[model samples]
Target: MLFEKTYGIDLGSSSVKVYSMIRNKSYIEKNMIAAKGRKIIAVGNEAYEMFEKAPSNISVSSPMAFGMIANLELQEIVLYSMMRKIDKILGIGSVMYFAVPLDMTAIEKRAYYQVANGHWLRKNRVYMVEAPIADAIAMGVDLENNEGSMVVNIGAQSTNFSIITGGRIIISKKIPIGGRQMNEAVCSEVRKRYNLQIGTRTGKRLKLVMGRLADQHKQARKVVGIDSVSGLPREEVISAYVVNAGIMNCVNEIGAQMKVFLERIPPQIAYHIAKEGIFLTGGSTRIPHIDTYLASYTGYSFNLSDLYETSSVTGLEKIIHDRELRKWAQPITQRKL
Candidate 1:
C-alpha cells in the first residue's frame, strides 16, 4: 500500500505539520533540530525543548527560515528524521503535498522539490500548493464560485495575503512582518522601560495574551533577564501595557500593508472580497483580540479560522481526499521522474 499512502506536509518556519491519510489525523511539532557537530541529537518537540536553554556545543535551530529552506543539509536531516519518527511508512511511493509560500523564488521552489525528492517521497510524487490556497480551503471557502475572497495568514516570520477568485490566486503579497516582529517589539519595550533584557520566547508569551493596547488585560507575568543597569541576572514583572506597547508598531504595520494590498486590487475583486469579508489564519492570529484589531483597519470583518496553525495542512488533506476540489490549485507535477 506504499503507493496508496498520502501525506500533507506544511513546512512552516515555526513548525512542521503533517497529515497522514492512512491514520486520518494530523501531527504537528516545532520545526527545530538540536545537534552537536555533524550528528543530530534530536528533532521536533525534543529539539524545541532545547531552544533558548541549551548549553554551549548544543545548537538548536530551524532548517527553514522565513518560509524558505535556508539550509538544505539541515532540512534533509530534519525532514527525514521527522517523517520517520512520525511513521515508518512515509518514505518511498507515498504521495506528498507541501504547502509552499507565495513569495518564494524559482530557486527556492526548486529547493523544496529537492528536499522532498531527496527522500521521504517518490521523486515525482511530490507536489506543491500555494500556502494561501491551502488556508482558504481549510476555511471551507467556495473556491469554485465566481465570488472572490481574501486570505491573511499571519505566521512567525511573515504575513501572507492572497486574493482567491474562481479557485485560483489572482493576486498575492507577502510582508516581512509577523510574530517575530511583535516579539522583538516586546523585547525592545522591556529593555527601554524596565531596563531588562528578555528572551524572544518570553516576549512572545506576553504578546499571545495581550497584544492589543485597547484590550490590555490587567495582567502581569514574571520574566527573568539581565538587568541593563547592573549587567546581572534579574527578575522583573512585566505588565500588559509593556507587551502591548512592544507589539503596537508591528500590528499597525500589518494593518497598513493590508490596506495597501486592498487598494491595489481591482474593483471587481475588491467588491467580491468586501462582500465575502476576510479570512484570517496562522499562528500569530492566536494573539488576543488581533482579529478585532485588524478588522478596525481593513474595514471588513475578520473571521479567524479554527485550528489556524494547522489550517494549511488541513487544506492539503482536503485536496488529497476530494478529487473534485483538486482544481482549486495546480500541483507541481514531474511526470518523467
Candidate 2:
C-alpha cells in the first residue's frame, strides 16, 4: 500500500494556508502570482512583492478574487508551488481537505476538485469542508450541540456572514466588501484630502497602522506618494482620523447588512446568538476596536477570535486530525455512473 499524508488547505484571496498532519505545522504565503505573458515569474510572497511595482510587461496579481478562484491555472500553479515547498515529492497520494465558501456554485466547487486533482496533484484525494463550519470548530464551538452560532468572517476581498446549528450551516452570505474595499477607500480619502495618489498596498499599510473605531487616537504616519497636483513623488503625513474614516465607511455598511441579516433569522436563533455573542474572525477583524465598533452598531456583543485569518484553516486542522470531526468534511467528487 502506498503511504498517504493528510493536508488541510484554506485558499484565501490574500493568502493560502496549508496544514500538514505529519509535520503538525501550518504554512501561510501570499496567494499571488507574477507572470510575463504565459510564462510564470514568481509565486507567493515573492510575487506579492512585485505587486503594483512590476513593470507593465509583467503582471502581478492574486489568482483569487472575492474568496473565489478567478484564474484556475494560476491558482493550481500557486497550490502546487506551495505544496512542493512542504513536501518535496508533493505528497502524491495525499488526502486533502479544503475549507470552501458555502455560497459557491457547482462550477466554482468543481474548481476546487480540479485544482487538487490537476497538474502534479493528480494522485491526491480531495474533500470539502464548509469554511464557516471550519471557522466554528476553530472558535471552539461545539458543532453537534450548537443551538445557534453566528460567524462573520471578514476576509481580504469579501466578508462572509453565516449561521451554524447542529453541525450544519443554516444561513450563509458573502458580501463583496472587505479589506480590499477598505484599502481602496483609504486611497480615495487620501486623494481627496491629501492630494496624494497612493496605491492600495500603501493604503493597506496606513489602514493597518492607524485604523481605529472607538477611543480614536491621534496618530500620523509618513507616506510617499505621487502628488495629485505635480504628478511627482512626495511625502505626506496621513492621520489616523483620515484612515479610520475610510475604514468605517466599509465597516458601517457591513454592520448595517448584519443587522438586516439578524432581523430575518428566526427568533430562537437570535436568542441563542444573544446569549452567546457573535463569533468574529478574519483578516480584516484585526482593525483596532473593530469588535467594539460592530457591537455598538448592531447592539450585540462579539466574541473576537485571535485566530483571525487562520480560523478556517485551524478548524480544518482539527477536522483533519480528529476522526469524529471528519464527518464534517464531505467528499466533493462523485463516482462515475
Clashing pairs in 2: none
lDDT of each: 0.83, 0.92
Residue by residue across 20-117, what tens digits does model 1's lDDT show? Answer: 88889898888899999888898888998888899899999999888888888788777777778678756466677888887667678778777777
For residue 38, give model 1's deviation from the true position in Å: 1.8
Best by TM-score: 2
- TM-score of every prediction relative to native: 0.93, 0.98
Model 2 lDDT tens row, 48-125: 999999999999999899999999999999999998999887646679999998867888987898899887678678
Give model 2's clash tally: 0
